[model samples]
Target: MVVESGGNARAGRPRAASAAQILEVAAQIADDDGLEAVSFRAIADRLGTSPMSVHRTTGGIDALRRELVAALVGDAIKAIDWPTGWREMCRTFAYALRDLLMRHPLVLEAHRQSALEAPGADDIAHRVVRALRDAGLCAEEAAYAYATLHDFVTGHVSIRLGRGDFESTTAPAERRGASVFVDHHDYDRRFETGISLLMSGIGATLAPRIRS
Candidate 1:
């Protein structure tokens, strides 16, 4: 999806770089050093241009960040071609999105902040909803199912990322302490089981409604 920005050029000179170029540089910076590391000058320096030129093309830093998030999410959505079968489709999408968001932690933050209110997000939502409808769900039922499934995936990934306290350290003493105090959960297995239950629940509910 093309990024929505203010203008294509600066005051007098024609801007040499595209929004995509600027956004990619910004996304790279954010992905490497966290989102706070990204700034207009940072992107400009990487692009070998002035900060004003970046601003002219991107509108401002906020818009630039928004576009960066959109590009990342859009790429994630495009990575998984629509799989066949309802169960396969839903599970594949959930896992794919989880993997992508996990790769770019800042994108998760941006998604939480803006909900991806762009064409990229819309496309992703539409594909999942369409899968539900294809599996005998009516419009309203599909909407609800999509909401439940999407929320589950988003929440799971968010929790996994936000659970930094429980991640990365496997020391014996710490493991013992965590086992005693934190009661660690196998999130991957938990997510798969939950996905099965969710899809089954939707099928049970939607099948009856479709029959009646």
Candidate 2:
């Protein structure tokens, strides 16, 4: 049965499919091929429907792109089931977002020109702010910390994933030279160290003000 734009199918009409479902299919198209492949006509072809049918539900390509970004961010947030503490939660959330972006590299490109005021973005930002405040950071400190953590995680993941270097290719002697001073270590340790360094810097900067 065909889905209508309003979410509910009219009497005698096919059952209405959710925007989420449409976005999911669109996301698959984007993820598998790239965001450029996520046109209304493409989605319609994937769904075995006419381009007009998809356009009627999604409004247009721009609307579909917006919905796709929202869906991806929402999915990333949902995947983060961290522990109670603010630091732990932030770490988990950061890693989860990194993983999601790495898995869906197209999302990184899609959000390049988009504002961060989207629904899921706002919710994630609020959560980060709340977590930082709970960790004894002031609003300004929390904002800075959030930005720093996001930049580090996103930048690291983008580099790693974009280079397609999850698997090492160098020999043992070459691998040892990869680290200038320290010995070769697991990637997870490197990630944790980066997160810890950021958290420590934030704590140090805010401690004086917070204690005053």
Candidate 3:
């Protein structure tokens, strides 16, 4: 490892590691000590290279963070056993996403910033929307459902991450008084409940209208 004024400068020429190696080490640091700790300097020290090499390989630290988050979420999504049925598929996806974000809370910010990178593009959006349409919702309704489910899952993670810190932003309820809302911070139950409500509402919206 290099042990310099900035980091630990060692005696040998820094070991030549690829971008993949840099990413793997950076992920380790992030997993162990949060994303804030996974700096270029930190990754360089771990890889026994200069921060400039890490930077050139990754384009920049921000790009590295985006790539790492994208890789992780994309892989995790691929690993899920996506159910054949729409409702079940939705539930499976919701749980999988929540589990992943809970493990790596920092990735959510990167996810939002990068459009969840490529995973949020065709892969996820297509399946969910098509499933919603198959479940009897029209294109417009399917679009809304997609937006709602994505917002719900991301909102759940954000709430847990920024709960007490965001108390002042909660809206006041007449019966409940000025309460910091989070459905009692029970996301496990709330996620399932939201899915059920979404499916049920979608079904209702598809009901035939009565003649005047």
TM-scores across all candidates? 0.73, 0.75, 0.74
Ranking by lDDT: 1, 3, 2
lDDT of each: 0.76, 0.72, 0.73
lDDT tens readout by residue for model 2, 46-87: 555566777788888987887787777776777667578677
lDDT, candidate 2, at 34: 84
- For model 1 the TM-score comes to 0.73
- Model 3 misplaced regions, further than 4 Å: 1-9, 30-37, 164-185, 207-212
Expressed as tens digits, the lDDT of each residue in 1-212 for candidate 1 is: 43333343334464456777887778778978888788977776666667888898989888778777777777777677777877788888788877887788887777776677555677767777888888888889888888888789888888887775356354466666756435546787778888999988987977776788
Supply candidate 3's per-residue lDDT for 196.
86
The 10 consecutive residues of candidate 3 with the worst lDDT sum are 1-10
Residue 140 deviation, candidate 1, in Å?
Answer: 2.7
- Report clash pairs, candidate 2: none
Model 3 gets an lDDT of 0.73
What tens-digit string does per-residue lDDT give for candidate 3 at 1-212?
Answer: 33223244457665556877877787778877878787888988876787887888889887888788877877787788877877777777777877888777767766666566656546777788898888777788787888888788889878876663344346445533544443464556667788789777766676653111
lDDT of 2 at 70: 72
lDDT comparing candidate 1 with the true structure: 0.76
TM-score of 3: 0.74
